[model samples]
Target: MTQPVPTTPRPAGTRPPELEILIPAYNEEHRLPTTLRALGAHLSRLPLRTALRVIDNGSSDRTAEAVDRVAAEGVPVTVTGCAQRGKGAAVKRGVTTSPARWTGFCDADLPTPVTAVDHAVRLLLEGWPVVVGSRRCLGAQLPVRQPLHRRLGGAGFRLLTRRLSGRVTDTQCGLKFFRTSVARELFAGVSCTGFAFDVEAIARARTLGVKVVEFPVAWSDQPGSRFRAGRDGLRVAGELWHLHRARHGTQRPTP
Candidate 1:
């Protein structure tokens, strides 16, 4: 395990960052650098103050080194580590620790284009507390189709999630954002620490009365996905069932 490198701490009384984008990486030495560069370039043109943090999720490769290299190039990148090896755990750690007004996580492969962050920020500024990218929504375009087995598995997952959460399609989409405070509160109570975490998050949001809007996004099926359709899919199914049984009473929306 590589030790986390230190970065300059924010000065006291300094205004918190407007947005923090967390990319959960596991053995993404080849793909993460490109994603970070693209994200940095896109964020530079926007006026909002932003920071990027890559959560190294127990990656055995030099993913952390790649992040350090990118940061050296002035890409505004930082990194943290999660001993637990799950995307949900990494994202939860990142979001909970972020001081930014808005925070979110996207796939390391950037299946949804980095430009989707622009739309998410706009929605957050417009009083939407939770904004998520969706490939199953109307107007969404998938440039590259997923393999048939993956597509079938996704459909089944979506169906199961809808039954549990009601009409919320595409809970597994890798890009999602929330108001930082709200996100912290939500993640603090999160139970699932695996791929099924998304389903739990959305269900929790609904129980808490947080309005979640799914924005149609242009997405592509990227190679090197770590999802194991048979193994992980069954694990996710079990998690969903547990979420269905858990009692989550309605709570007041975060103000």
Candidate 2:
């Protein structure tokens, strides 16, 4: 399928001049063009300068080509090819390689509105350790098209995370910001390379005394999601147990 060509003007660098937005895209050729459009439309208006990096996690489709198109438009996009796949591994690569002091990761689908992203970055500037987007927080305006089981599963996962990690609510949101110095260390220590990577990041952050702040987000579901909840659910469950064991064992990394 011929994808729509990107129409937005290139975004100028922002004021703070050191923020990097790391987008982990896997097989998102169909969705990335629109996602980048929305993000570019909003970011082009912001005053903070940022470097945008798109890490292609071994996509078998046109994902790399699509991102290369954006890079050709002078969008400050860096596409790194990785043989190892998974969201966690992709995020780790993006975080560890960033030159900026502040780094963030957003889903390629960009389910949250771009304005909300501005808010999260603002919170980051306000002295938060890790500024995270939340769908369960009060005042959250979520997508109307989410399936019932997905919502229930999200709630269940957050509940388990609360008990297991003893952290704030909503650990699975795709949008999360970290200080570059902290992210460099955090991603280096992360072990899980799949869906439960978020939990592992949070656990390691808390263990390392990383201050965390949650920001309420306006989120909407996008189509063409690749996650299989049933299969991933079992994987996450096992990861949770393994994470706990690692936390208690001598294998845990020192903060």
Candidate 3:
């Protein structure tokens, strides 16, 4: 049963948040509170008035209570529900609802460090439309590597998505920031709502001529991830094919 949820955000009145970081969680009652506190602590140091938001993807656990508990500690946490349970759907809900100047989503486990948020906001202020954390970029560190099967799957997935995602080295990084305007534009017409959503978002960015910056970070495989390569790989492949078909069908014929 769903318990009564958290607070209406502390209204900033005319001024919007300078940056809003979104945590998309599904059944994360055990793990999410730590992420919320860590992120809130880091965000507090930024010069910008940052706010934290969570997209509760219809979790059956006590996820909502965890968010409220974290917020009660003086960290501004506002959580919204996503009946559609998927990282992509949660991200869509958060980005579409955000009015902040800068917005982004990180996984509940947050393989990328919370400190990366400061650099992300800095890059957004420097006029980069999108800042994407990359495991494939130089200077990236994986203190713990993914199992070999997963790593091999990742490489094949990249090859399959190359055309749609442009030449972006890593599109599936859970850490990504966007100028709100760019995020709104890119995600507004998107239809994918799976793990493959990042690929679709990147593809849309290229089509619109918005630049995406890949920032290397110390990202690692986090425990308790919901994704199962064996079980979900076909679904992601199907989504990718659908994206290709949908985009291809809309193109104008060459002269």
Candidate 4:
């Protein structure tokens, strides 16, 4: 599945980056090895200073041990334990704990390759408050193994998001980058702990007048996703409604 080219252009500049890559893992012991290896190789080739954060979300598996083993290999790796489940909770913990100039979180499965990290960092360097992988954007390529029903669900979700949030082309991409200031501001206000957290984050960023750039991503769908599309979709939709009401509830009075 080829991605559509992005109409949104990145702001331009050249700056050496202090980037922290945050990976939120849940029962990803088998997947972590490949993802970490790919990320390590990519970071080794880059000139930017990079640190890796693996937030273990109370996996019954050996995910924490695998991350510890990788950290022992001399990479600037840090692991945080979030006993609470949910990807959003893990990301919140990691972002708040990481001490980098710029912070970003990627799914531990590496559905989007590490090269996308470079792209996201470049967007941050260019002055965007947040940069995100856009699966709906041009140049994004999804793997053939992706289930059609999930794809259809994603399309519907993006479409509904367009109606709710007018400025974004994609809202649910797992790879996201944020400048430290932006991350601090946005994540502090984040209340969602489930799949709809991405939408909430993006909404808050927009509310704060943060500049966001959605870039095309090269993504591959991986098996063993813990997501249950139908069940999770209902939860996501309900959360979106809650967020919508919260935004309205918090609106400032006009002069």
Candidate 5:
């Protein structure tokens, strides 16, 4: 149900990146530079080959230019514009176009430490097709917490979406990784585009019987988050209802 997202062209002879990390951005000109710097630094130390890309989701500001300015020494950063506007839409575009062995999307803000990538790569190479960071997991650490309202709303969201999420503890965590082929198959069926897209994606994974595992991480709540509790929460609630109904029939397009 997602429109096509374009890929950054690679020279025919070059091997694709081994690790492709996607960051979905909207008007992130100010914060993106720092994130790219930090992420690029961490990626440079890893032995695995890495590719960093940003999905500029119709940003009114110069988010793309910001990415251009803070170039990484080891981790080359590529910026691609997503015509689709929602965060999930941007992530879907990036994931579907990934040409790497391992692909996944993270938030523009480094809420989850970039080091989590180490464990993610480990899990994926260990044969887990899907791996996501979990704030609700046993070893999770929350150094900086989300606002009180967000914390409460997140709890309710999890409770309502529990059936769809299954054993996965945190579906909304921005840090998620997947083996390339499995990531594509799951995202190719994504129908919702807003914040609730995570719920829809998880539901699709459940329907397809794809096994998803969560890794605990130290999560810090970053400022300038665009998610409005009252308004966005209602939309997420509505999306959940639609997903529940879809479970009866006609949830996904025929392959």
Candidate 6:
């Protein structure tokens, strides 16, 4: 396990934040500035105390320095280091350390807009313990579509997720939220720490009877995605099979 290093200390006598958004980044120095600025601006307009944290997922770039720059601009952003090199690991560390009423993780590229945070927070305040941003759900707007091959791959992955975890149309949306206490408890038991981690996390949440709602959002396919269709896809499939067998005591379902 890796320990997180906080770049800035929280001021004394400050109220605990109502929400904390974690961005798990790997070599995202150039992208962090724009994403952090937009996120800070969006959060400022909402009527809630919010904080942002960037988990540096073993990036060899200036990702941490970029976060520090944002914090210096008085954005209330914090940078933390994660020795482990997986999105799920970084998110687990962030969720465990968060001291907010609600916590969630979003992709570094901001595929789902920062405004979706407000939407998710509203659902949480309305008694939804878990909220997910979905691009395939009703009312979703996709301004830019993913490549045809990628869309086909996503469809297959979604089918597998539905089989293992019931009725979740899109588990890999990269924007997920949870009540703080519930997030801590669930992440503590997480074992998958890669592309398929979302599937396992949602599956576990379902088994624990957590109420989850998916909200459709406006989305755009961002450039410089780290996911490699063939390599990462195979690894995710294997992990899904392992997760299914471990939980259900049966062979993995075919997508």
Listed per candidate, the RMSD to the true structure in angstroms reads 3.3, 5.8, 3.2, 9.4, 3.6, 2.8
Best by TM-score: 6
Q: What is the lDDT of candidate 1?
A: 0.85
Which ten residues in a row are the worst by lDDT in model 2? Answer: 2-11
Tens-digit lDDT track for model 5 on 1-255? 777644455547977789899999999999888888888888988888887999989899988778777753444788888997788899898889888989978999889888899989889989988888999899999999988988888888889888777777899999989888988898898878889888777777777878788899999999999898778778778888888887755554222
**How many clashing residue pairs are found in candidate 6?**
0
Clashes of each: 0, 3, 0, 6, 0, 0
Flag clash pairs in model 3: none
Better of 4 and 6 by TM-score: 6
lDDT of 4 by residue, 1-255 (tens): 644321112126623237888888888889987788788878878778786778888789898788778767866566678866788888888777666788888887888867787788777878988888887777877764468888788778877666445567778778988888778888898888888888878877777777788899877888788889778778888887887777675764221
- Model number with the top lDDT: 6
Please report how far candidate 6 places residue 250 from its true position, in Å. Answer: 8.3
lDDT of 2 by residue, 1-255 (tens): 644323223346744337778788888888887777677667667767776777788788999788778767766665666556888888887788777878998999888878887887788888786888888777887755588888888878777777445546788889999888888887788888888888888887877878878888887888778788888778788888788777664544333
Off by over 4 Å in 3: 1-15, 249-255
Let me know the TM-score candidate 4 reaches against the reference structure: 0.86
TM value for model 3: 0.92
State the RMSD for candidate 3: 3.2
Off by over 4 Å in 2: 1-17, 249-255
Q: Give the Cα lDDT of each candidate.
A: 0.85, 0.77, 0.85, 0.77, 0.84, 0.86
lDDT: the better of candidates 1 and 2 = 1
Clash pairs for candidate 5: none
| lDDT (Cα) of model 4 | 0.77
Misplaced by over 4 Å in model 6 are 1-7, 250-255
lDDT per residue for candidate 3 within 137-239, as digits (tens), equals 8888899899898899999999998878776899998999999988999889778888999998888888778898988888878878799987688889899
TM-score of each: 0.91, 0.87, 0.92, 0.86, 0.91, 0.93
Write down the worst ten-residue block by lDDT for model 4. Answer: 2-11
